[model samples]
Target chain A: MIDIFTKFSGQLFVGLGWTILSSVIALFFSLIIGTVFAIMEVVPSKIARFIGRAYVEILRNIPLLVITMFFYLVIPKYVMKINGFTAGTIGLTLYTSAFIAETIRSGIQSVSGGQMEGARSTGMTYWQAMRYIILPQAFKIVIPPLGNQFVNLVKNSSVLAFVAGFDLMYQANSIASTTFDQINSYLVVGVLYLIITLPLSYYMQYLEKKLA
Target chain B: MSMIEFHDVQKYYGHFHALHDINLEIDEGETVVLIGPSGSGKSTLVRTVNGLETIQKGQLIVNGHDLSDPKTNLNILRSDVGMVFQHFNLYKNKDVLENIMLAPRIVSHIPEEENKKRAMELLEMVGLEKWAHNMPSQISGGQKQRVAIARTLAMRPKLILYDEPTSALDPEMIDDVLQVIKKVTNESGMTSLIVTHEMGFAKEVANRVIFMDQGQIVEDENSASFFEQPKTVRAQQFLSKIISH
Candidate 1:
């Protein structure tokens, strides 16, 4: 691992940078998509609820690799050709969003029972209670789970490697095959992944504490 | 004019009858107390007046809005009605003062400065002026109930419902909550319906006492007359049981 780290430091750092970039982009888009779908699932309208449910069910149940491959292979073949990194990031976002939607929806549904009644009894409309009382508390409740999702998103950025996105895992694969030191190359990349994820996990815990 | 009227109102929770043939009238400025066994529908009946619980049959008119009609805007009707829960249910994220000021600012569209003034006055009325900045969790159960009452009164509701407001309080704390409630009803003269186990508070604060059993009103009488001689056997037994305990 030390030899791999010293010899291919430049290549490894570049891969790590790409990994971080993909993860950041995917995380941002997924949260927005997740929150929108979660709202759709809970709204009083039946059509919106169905569409949200279907979206989540289809995306989360399918294997993430297949989704990425479809975007990479099919989009470039028939439609406008796009790079592997864009395809991989899009795949990661949609896949993670399904799970994020579920997490947020559960948090919204579990907001303390009396909170809604208290607001409504004061003559506030249902939307008013949802906006002022329910959503704020629900956001607090989801912080821990949302943190988990974020960490998972960073790790799942490895999906980029399969699409030749040049993330850490992809670079590790090239270095291991060339140097014939698979164990050291993969181990170095694994440590780099941990460095990114550990801080994210701790940041979430800090946020949870500050809010509480 | 009557503040609330229930004409042959019936309510059910999936085939279990929660209220049966409720026919009652609460005039403006009347203070009524509802007393009953644990599942005798006292809470259910009071909840109906505010459209919190929907009746499957008959009419409920609250502040001149016919709740039985689907077209009636519950939001407008509820502006004139307020409810205090046994659990106190103050918004957990807001400070005590914000809890009182929110509805008036948002629902009633009151001006900001006036809303703050009224909120502070309500906090003072409930004897929690110093605790205005505290969160609901930082306050005691009694203080939270008082805050809940002040929050209700901020909307200038024409009628207020107390659903066993002190049921969740500690024994020593119950008196403080009851006293605040007594003062609110006496001074404001807003039509009030209370569900309570505290017979003494009911006798002192209520002009009328309603006795309910098995989802029906067994006795509805003037508080003094009911206390002097309950006409129904069930009412007498209930009062004696409460008194003996």
Candidate 2:
């Protein structure tokens, strides 16, 4: 195990950097897309709800690897050229966004109907009521579940390994094959994944308490 | 001029008829109190005036805006017509002062400095100035209602609707809320329509009283006459039942 670490430390660090970058990019874009879709699902417009529902359903139902491969293999060949990293990050974003949308939609629904009524009765527009009153309260209610999605996102970035995106899992696989020490290589990667997720969950718990 | 007029209004919640033939007119500066048993369509009637509940059949006009017309902007109408709910419905995310200041600044686009000043004055009027920074959950139920009233007043609406304002407060807290309502209505002299079960409060503040049952108006009379001698047998029985309770 020590020898594997000494030999592959540089490769492992590069993989760790790519994993963090992809997760960060995916997390940011997914949150924005998810919130927009969540709002669409609840908005009074039938067309918007249909579009939002279709987007979430289609993305969430498809396998993550299939979606990534479509972006990697199909899109570059037909429409535009893109690297493995870009394709995997985009895939992670859309996939994670669907779950986030569902989580956030539940949170929005959980907020008392009276909150929207109160804001609307005051003459604020639907969007205004949603922005100032509903969304803030909904976000607070969903922090725990949202945190779960964020952790899942980090773990799922491992899908990048199949596409040669050079994320942590891909590095672990390579190191284990070369060093013939699969157990230690995978164990170390698992611990590193925990390092990202544990703090995130704790931070969410802290946010929930602070808001409460 | 009438502030609110409902002609043969009908409201249905899918198969259930919530309001039946709500023909009513409320003139400017008149304080009317609607009293009825639970599920009597009193709340539905008030909500319709501000376009909160749409009428499927008939003409509903409030502050000269035709609520039945699809072209009519409900947001504009709602700014002129304020509603107070049974549960107070103060914005949970905002503090007492922000609750009052929000609609004015956002809907009316009032200058922030002036809006803040007016909000403070309204809070002072409701005697919640000391609690300006406190969140809605931090306040008592009665205080929340009072803050709600202050929030409504911040818009300086031409007409105000109170849908069972004291219904959610504690027994001891009801009086304070009723007092504030009385004071605001009397001083502002705005067209006030209140739905309440407090017969005494109704008798004190209302010039007219409307009695409703099973989604229909059973009696519409001057407060004094209605309280003294409810004309309809249904109204009399309802009054007697309430009095006994």
Q: Estimate each model's TM-score.
A: 0.93, 0.98
Segments of candidate 1 deviating more than 4 angstroms: A40-48, A74-82
Model 2, B178: alpha-carbon shift in Å? 0.5
True contacts kept of 1: 0.73
Residue B165, model 2: Cα distance from true site in angstroms: 0.5
Which candidate wins on TM-score?
A: 2
Please state the error at residue A8 of candidate 2 in Å: 0.9
lDDT values for all models: 0.94, 0.93
State which candidate has the highest lDDT. Answer: 1
Model 2 C-alpha lDDT per residue in residues A78-135, reported as the tens digit of each score: 9999999999999999999999999999999999998988899989999999999999
C-alpha positional error of residue B145 in candidate 2 after TM-score superposition, expressed in Å? 0.4
Put down candidate 2 lDDT per residue, B111-214, tens digits, no spaces.
99999999998989888899999999899999999999999989999999999999888999999999999998899889999999999899999999999999
